[model samples]
Target: MMRLIFAAMSGALFGAGLLISGMTDPARVQGWLDIFGDWDPTLGFVMAGAILPMAVAWRIAARRAVSFTGRALPTPPNPVIDRNLVTGAVLFGLGWGIAGLCPGPAMASLGFGGLPFAVFFLSMAAGMILFGLWNRR
Candidate 1:
Protein backbone atom coordinates (compact mmCIF):
# COMPACT_ATOMS: atom_id res chain seq x y z
CA MET A 1 0.00 0.00 0.00
CA MET A 2 2.79 2.39 0.89
CA ARG A 3 4.73 1.47 -2.22
CA LEU A 4 1.66 2.02 -4.37
CA ILE A 5 1.10 5.45 -2.85
CA PHE A 6 4.73 6.38 -3.38
CA ALA A 7 4.57 5.21 -6.98
CA ALA A 8 1.48 7.26 -7.67
CA MET A 9 2.99 10.36 -6.08
CA SER A 10 6.18 9.89 -8.08
CA GLY A 11 4.25 9.56 -11.32
CA ALA A 12 2.21 12.66 -10.57
CA LEU A 13 5.34 14.65 -9.81
CA PHE A 14 6.95 13.48 -13.06
CA GLY A 15 3.87 14.35 -15.10
CA ALA A 16 3.63 17.77 -13.46
CA GLY A 17 7.25 18.41 -14.24
CA LEU A 18 6.71 17.49 -17.88
CA LEU A 19 3.69 19.77 -18.07
CA ILE A 20 5.52 22.66 -16.44
CA SER A 21 8.58 22.21 -18.65
CA GLY A 22 6.54 22.42 -21.85
CA MET A 23 7.68 18.92 -22.80
CA THR A 24 4.03 17.87 -23.16
CA ASP A 25 3.79 19.99 -26.28
CA PRO A 26 4.80 18.18 -29.44
CA ALA A 27 5.53 21.44 -31.23
CA ARG A 28 8.12 22.31 -28.60
CA VAL A 29 9.84 18.94 -29.03
CA GLN A 30 9.69 19.28 -32.82
CA GLY A 31 11.25 22.72 -32.54
CA TRP A 32 14.07 21.32 -30.44
CA LEU A 33 14.78 18.63 -33.04
CA ASP A 34 14.83 21.15 -35.86
CA ILE A 35 18.54 21.93 -35.66
CA PHE A 36 18.87 23.08 -39.27
CA GLY A 37 15.93 25.41 -38.90
CA ASP A 38 14.68 27.38 -35.86
CA TRP A 39 16.17 25.10 -33.27
CA ASP A 40 15.09 25.39 -29.64
CA PRO A 41 17.50 24.45 -26.84
CA THR A 42 14.91 24.63 -24.08
CA LEU A 43 14.25 20.91 -24.15
CA GLY A 44 17.96 20.23 -23.79
CA PHE A 45 18.02 22.28 -20.62
CA VAL A 46 14.89 20.57 -19.33
CA MET A 47 16.50 17.18 -19.97
CA ALA A 48 19.64 18.22 -18.17
CA GLY A 49 17.61 19.42 -15.21
CA ALA A 50 15.69 16.15 -15.11
CA ILE A 51 18.83 13.99 -15.37
CA LEU A 52 20.67 15.83 -12.59
CA PRO A 53 18.18 14.74 -9.93
CA MET A 54 18.04 11.20 -11.36
CA ALA A 55 21.84 10.90 -11.33
CA VAL A 56 22.06 12.00 -7.72
CA ALA A 57 19.22 9.66 -6.73
CA TRP A 58 20.92 6.77 -8.56
CA ARG A 59 24.22 7.39 -6.81
CA ILE A 60 22.52 7.50 -3.43
CA ALA A 61 20.54 4.36 -4.18
CA ALA A 62 23.72 2.57 -5.29
CA ARG A 63 25.46 3.33 -2.00
CA ARG A 64 22.47 2.24 0.10
CA ALA A 65 22.20 -1.27 1.45
CA VAL A 66 18.60 -1.81 0.44
CA SER A 67 15.68 -0.03 -1.21
CA PHE A 68 12.31 0.90 0.27
CA THR A 69 10.95 -2.40 -1.05
CA GLY A 70 13.26 -4.31 1.33
CA ARG A 71 15.20 -5.85 -1.55
CA ALA A 72 18.62 -5.10 -2.98
CA LEU A 73 18.55 -3.43 -6.37
CA PRO A 74 20.76 -5.53 -8.56
CA THR A 75 23.59 -3.82 -10.35
CA PRO A 76 23.92 -4.45 -14.05
CA PRO A 77 26.26 -7.38 -14.75
CA ASN A 78 27.07 -6.07 -18.22
CA PRO A 79 26.66 -2.59 -19.72
CA VAL A 80 28.13 -3.10 -23.15
CA ILE A 81 26.71 -1.24 -26.16
CA ASP A 82 25.62 -3.60 -28.93
CA ARG A 83 24.14 -3.50 -32.42
CA ASN A 84 20.59 -3.95 -31.16
CA LEU A 85 21.02 -0.97 -28.87
CA VAL A 86 22.26 1.16 -31.74
CA THR A 87 19.43 0.02 -33.98
CA GLY A 88 16.85 0.72 -31.28
CA ALA A 89 18.29 4.16 -30.71
CA VAL A 90 18.13 4.99 -34.40
CA LEU A 91 14.55 3.80 -34.60
CA PHE A 92 13.62 5.81 -31.50
CA GLY A 93 15.16 8.97 -32.95
CA LEU A 94 13.39 8.41 -36.26
CA GLY A 95 10.06 7.93 -34.52
CA TRP A 96 10.57 11.00 -32.38
CA GLY A 97 11.44 13.08 -35.42
CA ILE A 98 8.39 11.93 -37.31
CA ALA A 99 5.87 11.88 -34.46
CA GLY A 100 7.22 14.73 -32.30
CA LEU A 101 6.36 12.86 -29.10
CA CYS A 102 8.33 10.32 -27.08
CA PRO A 103 6.56 7.87 -24.81
CA GLY A 104 6.73 9.80 -21.55
CA PRO A 105 5.58 13.13 -22.96
CA ALA A 106 3.04 11.41 -25.16
CA MET A 107 1.41 9.74 -22.17
CA ALA A 108 1.48 12.99 -20.25
CA SER A 109 -0.06 14.89 -23.16
CA LEU A 110 -3.03 12.53 -23.33
CA GLY A 111 -4.76 14.53 -20.59
CA PHE A 112 -5.41 17.19 -23.20
CA GLY A 113 -7.45 14.66 -25.28
CA GLY A 114 -6.11 16.02 -28.54
CA LEU A 115 -6.50 13.94 -31.68
CA PRO A 116 -2.83 13.90 -32.69
CA PHE A 117 -1.63 12.77 -29.29
CA ALA A 118 -4.40 10.16 -29.11
CA VAL A 119 -3.31 8.77 -32.44
CA PHE A 120 0.36 8.75 -31.45
CA PHE A 121 -0.31 6.99 -28.13
CA LEU A 122 -2.55 4.36 -29.75
CA SER A 123 0.01 3.64 -32.45
CA MET A 124 2.82 3.51 -29.89
CA ALA A 125 0.96 0.96 -27.76
CA ALA A 126 0.09 -1.11 -30.82
CA GLY A 127 3.72 -1.13 -31.90
CA MET A 128 4.81 -2.31 -28.48
CA ILE A 129 2.21 -5.08 -28.50
CA LEU A 130 3.30 -6.16 -32.00
CA PHE A 131 6.94 -6.20 -30.93
CA GLY A 132 6.15 -8.36 -27.92
CA LEU A 133 4.12 -10.77 -30.06
CA TRP A 134 6.87 -11.01 -32.66
CA ASN A 135 9.52 -11.58 -29.99
CA ARG A 136 7.49 -14.40 -28.47
CA ARG A 137 7.93 -16.47 -31.65
Candidate 2:
Protein backbone atom coordinates (compact mmCIF):
# COMPACT_ATOMS: atom_id res chain seq x y z
CA MET A 1 0.00 0.00 0.00
CA MET A 2 2.79 2.41 0.86
CA ARG A 3 4.68 1.53 -2.31
CA LEU A 4 1.59 2.08 -4.43
CA ILE A 5 0.92 5.45 -2.82
CA PHE A 6 4.56 6.46 -3.26
CA ALA A 7 4.48 5.48 -6.91
CA ALA A 8 1.32 7.51 -7.52
CA MET A 9 2.73 10.52 -5.68
CA SER A 10 6.00 10.31 -7.60
CA GLY A 11 4.16 10.15 -10.94
CA ALA A 12 1.93 13.08 -10.02
CA LEU A 13 4.94 15.13 -9.01
CA PHE A 14 6.80 14.26 -12.20
CA GLY A 15 3.80 15.19 -14.36
CA ALA A 16 3.31 18.42 -12.44
CA GLY A 17 6.98 19.33 -12.90
CA LEU A 18 6.75 18.66 -16.63
CA LEU A 19 3.65 20.84 -16.86
CA ILE A 20 5.15 23.60 -14.70
CA SER A 21 8.44 23.67 -16.62
CA GLY A 22 6.55 23.94 -19.96
CA MET A 23 8.22 20.69 -21.00
CA THR A 24 4.82 19.28 -21.95
CA ASP A 25 5.04 21.41 -25.10
CA PRO A 26 7.19 20.07 -27.92
CA ALA A 27 7.72 23.59 -29.26
CA ARG A 28 9.37 24.62 -25.98
CA VAL A 29 11.67 21.58 -26.04
CA GLN A 30 12.47 22.15 -29.71
CA GLY A 31 13.31 25.78 -29.03
CA TRP A 32 15.75 24.66 -26.34
CA LEU A 33 17.36 22.14 -28.71
CA ASP A 34 17.72 24.72 -31.46
CA ILE A 35 20.93 26.33 -30.23
CA PHE A 36 21.96 27.56 -33.71
CA GLY A 37 18.61 29.32 -34.06
CA ASP A 38 16.69 31.24 -31.35
CA TRP A 39 17.94 29.24 -28.39
CA ASP A 40 16.15 28.86 -25.04
CA PRO A 41 18.12 28.01 -21.89
CA THR A 42 15.05 27.55 -19.68
CA LEU A 43 15.11 23.78 -20.11
CA GLY A 44 18.70 23.62 -18.88
CA PHE A 45 17.75 25.37 -15.64
CA VAL A 46 14.75 23.09 -15.20
CA MET A 47 16.89 20.00 -15.79
CA ALA A 48 19.52 21.23 -13.36
CA GLY A 49 16.92 21.89 -10.68
CA ALA A 50 15.44 18.45 -11.15
CA ILE A 51 18.83 16.66 -11.11
CA LEU A 52 20.09 18.44 -7.99
CA PRO A 53 17.42 16.83 -5.82
CA MET A 54 17.99 13.47 -7.51
CA ALA A 55 21.77 13.67 -6.90
CA VAL A 56 21.21 14.36 -3.21
CA ALA A 57 18.70 11.52 -2.92
CA TRP A 58 21.12 9.14 -4.70
CA ARG A 59 23.91 10.04 -2.28
CA ILE A 60 21.64 9.47 0.71
CA ALA A 61 20.45 6.16 -0.72
CA ALA A 62 24.05 5.09 -1.24
CA ARG A 63 24.86 5.72 2.43
CA ARG A 64 21.69 4.13 3.79
CA ALA A 65 21.14 0.42 4.55
CA VAL A 66 17.52 -0.08 3.53
CA SER A 67 14.78 2.43 2.71
CA PHE A 68 11.55 2.87 4.71
CA THR A 69 10.81 -0.74 3.83
CA GLY A 70 13.11 -3.48 5.04
CA ARG A 71 13.87 -4.64 1.48
CA ALA A 72 17.37 -3.82 0.26
CA LEU A 73 17.67 -1.28 -2.55
CA PRO A 74 18.99 -2.80 -5.72
CA THR A 75 21.84 -1.03 -7.44
CA PRO A 76 21.84 -1.06 -11.21
CA PRO A 77 24.82 -2.73 -12.85
CA ASN A 78 26.91 -0.52 -15.14
CA PRO A 79 26.23 -1.18 -18.77
CA VAL A 80 28.93 -1.42 -21.45
CA ILE A 81 28.76 1.21 -24.17
CA ASP A 82 28.75 -0.68 -27.43
CA ARG A 83 27.82 -0.15 -31.08
CA ASN A 84 24.15 -0.70 -30.23
CA LEU A 85 24.24 2.11 -27.66
CA VAL A 86 25.83 4.53 -30.16
CA THR A 87 23.36 3.57 -32.87
CA GLY A 88 20.41 3.90 -30.45
CA ALA A 89 21.60 7.33 -29.32
CA VAL A 90 21.93 8.53 -32.91
CA LEU A 91 18.44 7.24 -33.67
CA PHE A 92 17.04 8.90 -30.54
CA GLY A 93 18.65 12.22 -31.49
CA LEU A 94 17.28 11.96 -35.00
CA GLY A 95 13.80 11.23 -33.69
CA TRP A 96 13.94 14.09 -31.19
CA GLY A 97 15.12 16.49 -33.90
CA ILE A 98 12.34 15.44 -36.24
CA ALA A 99 9.50 15.21 -33.69
CA GLY A 100 10.66 17.46 -30.85
CA LEU A 101 9.32 14.95 -28.29
CA CYS A 102 11.01 12.33 -26.09
CA PRO A 103 9.14 9.53 -24.31
CA GLY A 104 8.42 11.23 -20.96
CA PRO A 105 7.28 14.64 -22.24
CA ALA A 106 5.45 13.00 -25.11
CA MET A 107 3.31 11.00 -22.65
CA ALA A 108 2.72 14.07 -20.51
CA SER A 109 1.57 16.09 -23.54
CA LEU A 110 -1.11 13.51 -24.29
CA GLY A 111 -3.37 15.37 -21.86
CA PHE A 112 -3.60 18.18 -24.45
CA GLY A 113 -5.23 15.98 -27.13
CA GLY A 114 -3.66 16.42 -30.59
CA LEU A 115 -3.06 14.32 -33.71
CA PRO A 116 0.66 15.05 -34.14
CA PHE A 117 1.45 13.96 -30.62
CA ALA A 118 -0.68 10.88 -31.02
CA VAL A 119 1.19 9.93 -34.18
CA PHE A 120 4.54 10.53 -32.54
CA PHE A 121 3.58 8.54 -29.46
CA LEU A 122 2.23 5.62 -31.44
CA SER A 123 5.28 5.58 -33.69
CA MET A 124 7.61 5.76 -30.71
CA ALA A 125 5.74 2.88 -29.02
CA ALA A 126 5.99 0.82 -32.18
CA GLY A 127 9.68 1.52 -32.43
CA MET A 128 10.18 0.47 -28.83
CA ILE A 129 8.25 -2.74 -29.39
CA LEU A 130 10.29 -3.49 -32.49
CA PHE A 131 13.52 -2.86 -30.64
CA GLY A 132 12.44 -5.16 -27.81
CA LEU A 133 11.56 -7.94 -30.24
CA TRP A 134 14.80 -7.55 -32.15
CA ASN A 135 16.86 -7.53 -28.95
CA ARG A 136 15.16 -10.68 -27.74
CA ARG A 137 16.35 -12.61 -30.82
lDDT of 1 at 124: 94
Q: What lDDT is obtained when candidate 1 is compared to the true structure? A: 0.89
Q: What lDDT tens digits, residue by residue, belong to model 2 across residues 1-137?
A: 88889888988899889989978777888899999999999999999999999889888888888887666876765688899889989999888877778888888878784898888889999999998999899
lDDT of 1 at 48: 97
Off by over 4 Å in 1: none
The candidate that wins on TM-score is 1
TM-score of each: 0.93, 0.91
CA lDDT of each candidate?
Answer: 0.89, 0.86
Per-candidate RMSD vs. true structure? 1.3, 1.6
Best candidate according to lDDT: 1
What is the Cα-based lDDT of residue 93 in candidate 1? Answer: 95
**Poorest lDDT segment (10 consecutive residues) of candidate 2:** 69-78
User: What is candidate 1's lDDT per residue for 51-104, written digit by digit as tens?
Assistant: 999889888888888887877876755789899889988999999998788998
lDDT of residue 59 for candidate 2:
84
